[model samples]
Target: MGGPSEEPELWAFLESLHCGDILSGTVTAIERFGVFVALDDGPAHSVFPGVGFISFAELSSRRFEAASDVVQVGRRVSCEFLQFDTWNLEARLSLKATQPDPFQLFVDAIAVGEKLPGQVTKLIPFGAFVQVADGVEGLVHLRELAWTPVETPSDVVQVGDEITVVVTEIDRERHRVALSRRQGSSAV
Candidate 1:
């Protein structure tokens, strides 16, 4: 006779999953904020739609107009477990983790002082964020915006403006790229 039947075995399988574990699943649903996935050979989550969920930002390494553009319902995907949301009883997953990071590729392909054309995507008090590649963005600090001192970033660049910037620093660990528009200028 079995001491505790297969209950303990089932519990062990569910508990074995840890952060960074790669799991395969089918996309069950898509929402404005995230995607629901029904994991293959995984225990059902008690509160969420399925065993896993992927946030919008975790869906891809490249920017897309919508979640549907990146993944469709019934799409099979391999995702990395980010965390187990114990309160929500959901597995937080990242599809992008399985894919190559575009930012890393961009950094590897370029070097410091290389001028690249980018579009101004956002303006903030400290600087302007420019989209240098499909999913890669670099910050142009206020002091680097122009040769002349500028009180605000908007005074130098505006949203949707096409500009050239030179890579000043690359923080691969933090996935940050510092850029300088002033250095891109031929006058300097």
Candidate 2:
């Protein structure tokens, strides 16, 4: 969602579009949060320059350092329409929707209790994220980080640390992988 537009023409144009429709546009801006596109078939906006928007999370199915890594300003792109952002009066588009999801592919080949190698990518109070595959990061909850009690994920693993983890559970519907470090070490 984004700021509302005062142009009624822009709203009508965006309303004409539906989810899953492929729209081609020129990348008008790339902000920290998302990318804006000037749709070739849509009317001009009075508030924002473009009425088509793709959030960072919708830009790619893979992990990226920045928006530019996946798309650049002035580049032409085709994106799948996700929804009409009535609040922002913009078309919510998804670049990743047009691409295959690596997580689904990873899950299809992995099984529960399978041990795998991964690099600790992030540490939080609740859990640690491990990059088990490209675009596939599994959550190693605070309790799963070690057998003994730990205050935080950093107490067991730091960012960039190589670790072995057991895939304790997989929620296909939610696209989540639950991992356990203690179980992995014990299995070995």
Candidate 3:
């Protein structure tokens, strides 16, 4: 009764959600606390779930003193739904939740002498996030994304760009896999 006509109907949609999945949602309400959006569902009647959520910390970039400065009611917004609280009936979301730092899977599966194709999920001044396997990603730092100096990772790669990468270092405890684009380029 709370979710959809059939509970199973929503499983596919919910299954799509990873802990740090970042998706685009539409703004429905803008309050002093944060912004809320309606997340579009699949072919079914497009459930109008609360989607957009911007916390106080996310306003650091714009110095958003108030919610009004940050968002306008009924505007389309892109943010990450970090998690959904079933008991509370609230979605814990954030713009940064898309990546939510790095996970240990990459470091665990990677070996020093292996190669993996990395799809760039993000390009930043410092480094880039590459999806090696579903739910697992590796990081290609600015110095490793290219053979030459790159002031910005975007210059060498962009979000969704596919590149070859080599597993250079793996810190299993920290769960971070250091990747190198230059090292794997020749193999590709």
Candidate 4:
């Protein structure tokens, strides 16, 4: 066999698993791209100690600087089986799937046209990102920075400035919040 078919036993074992099934494993390696796990019930990987892999995005819903931010080597974890990586001959798992999604919770509790107090966290050329809640940020576009014409987001609001904003649009599918400081000021 060639390509992904090189590991028949591993392929058959991974094929037996289903998405959302809970898989137990020990953290084997942490790479910039993802984490590798030694699954408790699956056959050994041809190279790695484990046949389970978790990409950085699947490690957690929260933003992090490194793989160690969510897990460490030798830590035991239970993750949701997401899919089989036919190319790598590994099972793809999600640690975040086993935990609550903060974005979802935030969305459920908020509504459009709501006024919120937030602190500017990042200032980009087009807009500024304001943190309304922990790990929850909304964008205040340059045009919405103020009623007056502005060349850049910094001209209206600098990073770390506390400001009030009105939620103009809530994109549930895209996990985005479009805000307007001008509307918020007028609404106050």
In model 3, pairs of residues that clash are 37-51, 37-52
**Candidate 3: tens digits of C-alpha lDDT, residues 39-122:** 664322233336334666653232235777656777765666676544333455675444333354345545896988879987
Ranking by TM-score: 4, 1, 2, 3
Tell me the tens digit of each residue's lDDT in model 1 across 1-188. Answer: 11224444434444678889998989998988899999897676544567688999898978788999999999999999998664455678999999988998899999998999999999999999999998999999999999999999988799999999999999999999999999999654
lDDT of each: 0.86, 0.89, 0.65, 0.88
Candidate with more favorable, higher lDDT: 1 or 2: 2
The better-scoring model by TM-score among 3 and 4 is 4
Model 3 stretches astray by more than 4 angstroms: 1-108
Candidate ranking (lDDT, best to worst): 2, 4, 1, 3
Name the top TM-score candidate.
4
Q: Is candidate 2 or candidate 3 better by TM-score?
A: 2
List the lowest-lDDT window of 10 residues for candidate 2.
1-10
Error of 2 at 105 (Å): 1.6
- Give the count of colliding residue pairs in each prediction: 0, 0, 2, 0
Poorest stretch of ten by lDDT in candidate 1: 1-10
TM-score of each: 0.80, 0.79, 0.44, 0.88
